[model samples]
Target: MLIRDLPYADPGVPDVRSGRHFLLWLGRRQLRGQAKSLAWGTLHMASVASIPIAVGLAVQAVVDRSGGGLALAGALLALLGLGATVGDTMLHRTAVTNWITAAARVQQLLARRTAELGATLTQRVAAGEVVAVSTGDIEKIGWCVESVSRFSAALVVALSVCVGLVVYEPELGLLVAAGLLLLIAVVLPLLPRATRRADLQREKAGRATELAADTVAGLRVLRGIGGEELFLRRYRSASQEVRQAAVRTARMWALIEAVQVALPGLLLIAVVWHGTGLAMDGRITVGELTTVYGAVTFLLFPLRLVQEFAMAYSFSRPSAARAARVLGLRRSGDGAGVGDGAGGGEARSLENPAEGDLHDPAGGLLAPAGRLTAVVCGDPDEAGRLAARLGGHDPSAEEDPAEEEGERPDARERALPSVLLGGVPLDAVPLEKARAAVLVQDKDPVLLSGTLRELLDVPGSGRVSANEALAAAQCADVLDALAQGTPGLNGDPLEARITERGRSLSGGQRQRLALARSLVTDPPVLVLDEPTSAVDSHTEARIAGALRRVRAGRTTVVLASSPLLLDCADQVVLLQDGRVTAAGTHRGLLRDDPHYRAVVTRETDDELAEGTTHA
Candidate 1:
């Protein structure tokens, strides 16, 4: 696998058993690249090891006054230099390829998982954690992957050099071997402590990152409520905790580095001391003593390689574990035998499946095809849960059975039934198909940063035009507000840029823009939860009227208790105790059902009296 071929030609299903298993899976996926890296790394290290022998030969030639040997040594040195250059270049190239390819594979997996989970992703994992995994964690994992080949090559070169030394001078070779073994024994015991510290540091850093993200996301709200100082203090505390943890982790790693350096220096001293005795005893020549000293000095390079690989692996293990946790998350009822219809098997093979009515059996509500239906729930939470179900989302579907039994009964738990489309369970439909068939706009919809034109440009664009949707959403004031701030925009809202999360716009402006974006998609079924809650009563009335007119022949389910929106619906279903207790025209329900009237007419008496006084 090369960088160009990445994101993996096929990022095959991962073995998400554990973090260690996931790392192994990555290695298997790029076996060929790893092999190439190993081969080049071996060549590089071998040439590096050969340099000491060349230098020793040159020295001996000069001492013996042999011109032919000197020339031969020079020629050999040149060849080794050329080999080292080629090997080093290719080694670097292959290592980088491995790093990039591994990171790309992980990125692709994460992107796919995010798409599959959609809005529920943040519910299961922190947004900051996801961000951390995609950025820092990915780099650590790639670093480990890149180091593996180099480490293996270093081990091979180290062993080959040791064997050659043993054959050249048995007495000095035994001493060198014992010193190497002692170094390994001393360093190996310290690794677990270092790994533990690294884990602690990473945990603290993730919490700090999460706090920072949350603070930034709600900065506007914090300023509005005079709570900026409180959040700022909280973030500062988190940052300090992260700093302390990082310092502790750094200290442990520094100890390991000290050992790596100090142990090798000791080994080099032992070889030099012992080699001098062998040369004096006439058991080894001067050239042989030089070679022994040079080889031990060169051995430090491989020892450092081993230390680097250990450090990289320690950091990457936790990162891989985090990635695996995300990859292992499956949506509720995903691949379960519960709702197995359009989302699986032969039904998924269909190119253009027909559209149908949406039904919520548990709620005892039916949103007929091509009709505007409104749902009014006494409890806002119940209403939100019902809206999510209408879009084929059930949080309980993926919950553990034991934990599900332990929770107190709520609206969702009381009636845990799947929503259906045309008698087929909605969850049974493929997510893409279900998303295309039904568009659900939550109470707090997100508006991505982009030009108005770009925001409105959605997939499948024939059913509704951007202008029509904007008008229906009553975005004229929003457009005017945005245009007033920028003169070069030519008073065209479509050309104006919205800040991240539409932060530059007011709450009402952002809400309307989100509605317009949703309306532009023109899905067969549109389920909206409090779509006009942020607007004033008059503006809400306009939106209610416009929505009725624009969605005349499409299935629209609006979960709101607002009288204006409810009155505009052809049918109003009053949801109470997690079931549809009353269903009729809004006026009919107001006249006959006291409970329904009370729920919809929630305005204070002072407000009603004030309105009458104005009239």
Candidate 2:
């Protein structure tokens, strides 16, 4: 497919058998492009090889004093030069297309997998490794995939030229073939050392990248706790380690390059010496000597291509393996199947339940549609996991090897958790539909850089307008905060541009802004975790009041123990030790269930001092 037709509608399932297999799969996917590149590369190298041959023919004609033959040779040389130029241009164009398209395909696949696995991917794979795959590894893979055709062409033309020389004059031709073989022998042995060095460099670089990402992400926290210098020093040490590794890699490659150049020079000398001897001994003509010398010199171009192929393959193999490992990762439901539900058959046909209740069979909790439900749990982590499951994350999902090539993904008894929506398992629901049906706002939601309007713009039900969402989220002052920091945007608060991750906004402001954005989406089911923890109690109370009014008669699941939020819910459920312990109105739970009150209010000292008694 052309570059414009990218982001392949399917991106197809990847082959995760091994790193080498994954790379081979990538090449096979872009067959048409590779074919075009190979054709162009063949034309280019063949045309280049013809140039020296034409010059040698002209030299022979001139020596024989044949004016007609000399004139014919001149025209042939010009034609060969033009062909070389055009072929090289087209070859480069096709190769670049192959590179970009391959990279794009991998990037799209990664994005799709990311959405499928969601937050759990970060839990299974190191953040640094993921970054390296997306950044450095992607380029390496693309480079290797695109280089294959060119290297093939080089090998073909190199062999053809050698065969021609051998047939024309056995003496000089055999000498040239032997010299080429010797060059290959010497270069092949140095590759393993270079490969090891390259792998070391990539490892160190990945560690450094991870360190830098961590330091930057925590810069705000580091500065607050006076730990900025400590991290900076640590990063410096990591950076130096990476530098040393890189230098070692460069040294190995340099030695290889030196050998490459030195061997080719010696080969050219040997061919000239042998051809001169043959010409003087009446075994070859002066013109034949010219041709043999020219061919040997030109053969170096293809030999260098071989070296390039070797280096590219060594570096890309590990990268492909890493990408394969990531692609192979499947949700725990694919194998663990802890809570089976109809073999995930219902996932594809799911839609907004409209009035269906959300049921958690394992916990025996059912949240009726069109009601505000608050979930309280003693552990924040447990609450977070519940929220994730509620948002269609397979509770039993864990990363494992994806099905091998030629294996149907459907063959696996992929059983999702029995967390059902309208009797259909949430995990079984197709991700696109699941995302649309349920909205989960995490405790630490990230705000990407953009205008306020752009941030709020999402594929929403459109039932809740921007201003209404902002009001319900208690984000009135957030507009003022944006205006004060940004210039010339006071006229329209929506136009105010926020910096990366909303760095300019305070924790409370960022939280409210994210909450407002979430509200604007107006999904069929809304699930929030600690939505107002960063805000003051007063602001939290305002949000509670507006939240109930704006989201009236809608399915809202608030996973928090905040008294204000719980009191505002139509029904409150106490989730203890990963099970439903109590379910009732917030006030009823506080008055009747001592355990519920202990979790909601943290069992404060005043209650203990009074020695509050409960039946």
- Which structure among the candidates has the greatest TM-score? 1
lDDT by residue (208-256, candidate 2, tens digit) is 8888887888799999999999999999999999899889888888888
Residue 64, model 1: lDDT of 94
Top candidate, metric lDDT: 1
In candidate 2, stretches whose alpha carbon ends up further than 4 angstroms from where it belongs are 4-10, 114-131, 325-352, 362-365, 395-418, 489-492, 574-577, 581-615
Give candidate 1's error at residue 427 in angstroms.
Answer: 3.4
Tens digit of per-residue lDDT, candidate 1, span 110-194: 9988887777667567888888889999999999999999999999999999998888778888888888889889889998999
TM-score for each model? 0.88, 0.87
How well does candidate 1 score on lDDT at residue 290?
Answer: 88
In candidate 1, clashing pairs total 3
Q: Give the TM-score of candidate 1.
A: 0.88
